[model samples]
Target: MSEHDVEELKGVFDVLSSQIPALIRGIIASVFSEEAGREMGKAAGAFYKGLIEAGIPNDVAIRMTENYISVFTNLGEIMKKLSYKMEREGKIKKEAEEEKGEEEAGERAEEQ
Candidate 1:
């Protein structure tokens, strides 16, 4: 890609690098906060109770409850992974741009 294209890409990545982290942090905090924890516990208990009332076996009810809780945890994990990957990609792009700039400067110096 041309230098101008790379620079534009760098700007986009920089914006994403900042915004994505803030979004991820907000999501993670909300998911794991004390209020969220309490709500999750209540919800899981209600699910388990409902299953038991419906004549589901104790083991099955427990498993379902575990799965229900996993949904929230999984969301948090996915966001964390996405944030890490974006951060890593941004760093890689920045490093590549820096290296290309150095190479161009060196070539100019040799021609002078």
Candidate 2:
């Protein structure tokens, strides 16, 4: 590729490197937010009620609702794990001074 093409690719990567982590963090926050929890609970309850109305067994409806909730929780967990992995690999910055401050605080607590 030409020099111009390489420079354009690098610029794209620069923007993406900063934005991707923030996007993932935003998604994780939204997914686990209290409002989301309430909405999920309502949706699950409605689903279970609908199933029961259709003559599904109570136990089976409960199992289906549990599975529905698990899907949301699992997605949040996966994103959280991905964020941690990126931080560890230095794909996302953890800020050196922040980490040092946390470590020192932990050491002080341990001595207490």
Candidate 3:
């Protein structure tokens, strides 16, 4: 190939190499930002419509919202702890069963 074609190919390669990851990052960030914005908008609209429009005091609404969020966060923490406990219990049960099986096998071997 001619030097001019080689140079053109290098230019294209350089652009793709530099731009592809940047484009991907931009797209990912845009998607995440859009979704987050949509969620916040929906939450805000619901709060405004339900509480603020219903003539609830703005300070009361804010406090209620914070309390509501705290409740959910606490619930989430409780659920997480329960989930971990269940998982540990499951693992312990499995290990105990395995040990029992090993002990039974050992007794059979001794009998033989």
lDDT of all predictions: 0.89, 0.83, 0.67
* Residue 108, candidate 1: alpha-carbon lDDT: 100
Candidate 2, residues 1-112: lDDT per residue as tens digits? 9999997986786666667767889999998899998999899989999999999999999998899889999999999988777655444343664687799999999999
TM-score of 1: 0.77
Clashes of each: 0, 0, 0
lDDT of 1: 0.89
User: How close to the true structure is residue 111 of candidate 3, measured as C-alpha lDDT?
Assistant: 100
- Candidate 1 residue-pair clash tally: 0
Which residue runs of candidate 1 sit more than 4 Å off their true CA positions?
1-9
RMSD for each model, in Å, please?
Answer: 2.6, 11.5, 19.4
**lDDT, residue 82, model 3:** 56
Q: Considering only N, C-alpha and C atoms within 3 Å, which residue pairs clash in candidate 3?
A: none
Give residue 26's error in model 1 in angstroms: 2.2
Candidate 3: residue 48 lDDT (0-100) = 55
Which regions in candidate 3 have their CA more than 4 angstroms from the true location? Answer: 1-41
On the 0 to 100 scale, the lDDT of residue 84 in model 3 is: 56
lDDT at residue 41 of model 2 (Cα atoms): 89
Error of 2 at 104 (Å): 36
